[model samples]
Every structure is written in structure tokens, then in C-alpha cells.
Target: MTRRCGFAAVIGAPNAGKSTLTNRLVGAKVSIVTQKVQTTRFPVRGVALADEAQIVLVDTPGIFQPRRRLDRAMVRSAWGGAEDADAVVHLVDAPAQLGDSPADRRAQADVETIIAGLKASGKAAILALNKVDAVKREALLGVSAALYETGAYDEAFMISASTGSGVDDLKAKLAERMPEGEWLYPEDQTADLPARLLAAEITREKLYLRVHEELPYSAAVETTAFQERKDGGVRIEQTIYVERESQRPIILGKGGQTLKWIGQKSREDLSVILDRPVHLFLHVTVDERWADKRAFYGDLGLDYDA
Candidate 1:
């Protein structure tokens, strides 16, 4: 049997279930999912095996109006992912686009920006309407029709990423588009992220889950060290950076309970994912300019100058 492999970039507005869809297609949690928007900061490559085809899923950051350097870099990274991929999947939050709330309006506006970007690039994408279960079929059809009329999409699919509805069909379509080639990774490898980066990402996910409202996007997690011990266990040390000294209390909590909970939850998940006992250590620091640092962008594969 001939093997096929290609990159598929998944682009969308914040909270459009791109991460969830990537995880579902890859059959594992390679990207972090959270209720907060912009939880994904970089492109996470997840490998999905569809028979003889290897679908390299590039889960890019959500495209939004840029207000800061970090936001600009994130948006640039998102478009860069789409520009380099063999296929592109533009995922849209159906219910949000059909709603009238401020957030919903912003989401809809972001979707329009994405469509315009695609048009400017002269690239046609496969539109995937996410969270279809949350909206009526009539509304979905209307939304689908309006987007399809934009001429930026070649195909449309209504899918509920959370419930695994219509996901297999989308995956198969992506697989069929892959060009014939040797697989880029081992059959068992699901992601290409370094262990240190993956560890930091996991800790960052837990941090966001704990203090999404209190902490802004200024907080970052970095794995300082990962060591294998004699007992077949790993010791990982990470530092969580906050932009302001006042924000420290929110992460540390009263009696350091919040940070403790984040560390415990992260360690539990890391142990299960790594299939080894993990001793996770977390520390909090106030770095007002971490986002502006060049090293930070280099670590995340983002264009700092963007």
C-alpha cells in the first residue's frame, strides 16, 4: 500500500473548538483546550493516521484583531501556518456567529477577518462549522450559505467537535487530500513537540484553568528542567511568570493553595500522559516583560518582530 502525508492547517477564531477538533482527529490531547479564548499560543503539530495517510494537523493560534505585539505575533503565526500547509481547515463557531452578544459579535468579526485573509491570499479552504449541536440546522444552513457565498471555501462540514459528530468524515476528507509520500513520523508518535515544551504547555493549561479570569495573557510557563531519576520517574521544574507583582497573589492564592492545586492537577495529567511517575515543581515570578522578550517568541516558534 502506498503511504501519504501532508500538513493540514486548522485556523479559526478564538474558542471555535480548533484544539478539540485537532485532539479528536489525532485521537489524543496534543493541544490544550480551555473555556478562555487564545489559550493556544503557538502551532501544535499533531499526527493523525488515516489508513496509509498521515495527516499532520497544525493547530494554530486563534486569529483575532491585534492590539499588542504578542497578539500580532500570534496572528502572524496563524496565517503562516495556513500559508505553509497543503490543506487548510477554517473552523467556525456556529452558535457564536449566530448570536448577538458582544463576545459573539467579536467572534463573528474574527471569522470575517479570516475569510478576508483567505481571499487576500487567494487560497480556498474547507470550512468546518463547529459546535453545530448548539445551533439549529436551519441556522447552520444559513451560516454555511453565507460563508460559502464568500467564495473562500471549497467545501463545508457541520461538526460538533465536543461530541465527535461528523469528525470522522472531516478526517477522511483531509486524508484523501494528502499527497503520496513516506510517513514523516513513527506510527505511534502523535505529536512533535519537545518534552520540555509539552510539559510547559500542560502546566500553562492548568494555570489558565485555575485563574483564567484573574490572570490575563501575560502569564507564561517554562520548564526549567526535566530529569529522569533512578526509580524510573521524572522530576520536572517549571516557573510561572506573571506581568505584575500584584498578580502574584492570584496565582499563589491564600496559603499558596491555588498554585498547589495547579501543580497537583498538572502533575497528575503529566504522569498519565508520560506513563511515568512525575515530581512536578512549580514557582511563580513577576516578569513584566516576558512577552516582549525575543527568547519567548523563539521558544514558541512565533515571529517576535511581527
Candidate 2:
């Protein structure tokens, strides 16, 4: 039997359900999902097996207009993911694109940016109009047709990534498009992220979930150590860096209750994902320039000069 294996880069605006779709495609929680924009800061590769095809799904960061160095790096990384892929998927939040709210307008603009970028690259992407369950049939069809008319997309799919609606068809399309080649990862492997990095991402997800509104984007989590214990358990140490001293209390909360809760949740998730007893230790520190540091970018697999 012939085997197929290649990368499929998923690119879209912030909060367009790209991560959710990637997780759905991979049939596992390889990428983290939250009700927040710009949560993903880098490209995360998740392995998906569709029949004889091994689809290496590259869940790139959401692309949008950049105003900061980190934002530029993320945008560059997102496009770079598309540059080396056998397939490219442009996921859009259908409701957001058709709505008239200010946030929706912003989302629409970001989609426009993606379409313009695709046109410049001269690469046609498989358009996946996500969140179709949240919009009306007529409006969804109108928006889908308009987007397809732009010629940036070669094919279209209407899917709700969260509900798994119409996702199987999208998966089948991706599988058939994969190039005939050897598998890049073991069939049992679900993701290509380092364990330590994934642990840090889990912690960060917890942090954002707990205090996302209270805290800004100036906070990050990094795993300092990971040790295999003699008792067949794993011990992990991590630090949460903040840009301001005043912001530290927001994450720590009154009498450290917030930080404690974050740690407990992170440990619970890490234990389940790793299938081992996990001892997670968390620390909060004020690192005024964590975002500007080269080491921080390096750890997240981002370019400091981009």
C-alpha cells in the first residue's frame, strides 16, 4: 500500500478557531484553546492519521497586523509555516465575518489581511468557514461565496470545529491532498512539541483562564526544570514572569489563593496529559522586560530578529 505524509498549515485571524480545528483534525488536545485572541504564539505541529495518510498538522499562530516585535515574529512564523507545507488551510470564523459589531469588524479586517497575504504569495488555500453552527444558513453561504470569489481559496468547507460538525469531510480532503511520502513521526505520536514546552503551555493556559481579564499579555510561563523521580513520577518547576510589579498581585491574588489554584489546575492537566504522577511547582516573578528578552523568544521557538 502507498503511504502519504506532509504538513498542512492552518492559518487564520485571531480567535477564528484555528487551534480548535487543528485539535479536531489531530483527534487530540495537542494545541491549547481558550476564549482569547492571540493565545497561540507559535506554530504547533500535531500528527493526524487519516487512513493511509499521515497528516502533520501545523497549527500556526493567528495572523494579523503587527504593532510590536513579538507580534511581527508571530506573523512571520505563521507565514513561514505556510511556505513549507504541502497544503494550507485558511480557517475563518463565519459569524464574525458576517456580523457588524466592532470586534467582528476587527476580525473581518484580519481575514482581509490573510486574503491579501495569500494573494501576494500566489498560493491558494483550502477555505474552512468555521463556526457555521453559530450563523444562519443564508448569511453563511453569502459570506462563503464572497470569500471564495477573492480567488485566494481553491476549495471551501463549512465546519464547526468545536462541535465536530462537517469536520470529517474536511479531514478526508486534507488526507487525500497529502503527498506520497514516508511518515515524519511515529503513528502513536500526537504532537511534535517538547514535553517541557507543552507543560509550560498548559500552565500558561491555566494562568490565562484564571486571570485573563485581570492580567494583560505581559505575562508568560516557562518551565525551569523537569525531573524523573525514582518513584516513577515526574517533577516540574516553572516560573511565571510579569512585566510590572503591580500586576504580580493580580496573578498571586489575596493570600496566594489565585496562584495556588493555577498550580493545582496545571498539575491536574499535566498529570492527565502525561499519564503520570506530576509534581508541578510554580513561581511568580516580575521581569519587566521578559517580552524583549532574546531567551524568551528562543524558548518559544520564535525568531528574535524577525
Query: Candidate 2: which stretches are off by over 4 Å?
Result: none
> In model 2, which range of ten residues has the least summed lDDT?
28-37
After superposition on all C-alphas, the RMSD of every candidate to the true structure, in Å, is: 0.9, 0.9
User: Which residue ranges in model 1 land beyond 4 Å of their true spot?
Assistant: none
> How does each model score on lDDT?
0.95, 0.93
lDDT of 1 at 163: 96
Q: For each candidate, give its TM-score against the true structure.
A: 0.98, 0.98
lDDT of 1 by residue, 30-101 (tens): 999988789899999999999999999999999999999999999999999999999999999999988999
TM-score of candidate 2 on Cα atoms, chains taken together: 0.98
Please, what are the lDDT tens digits per residue for candidate 2 over residues 183-217? 99998999999999999989898898999898888
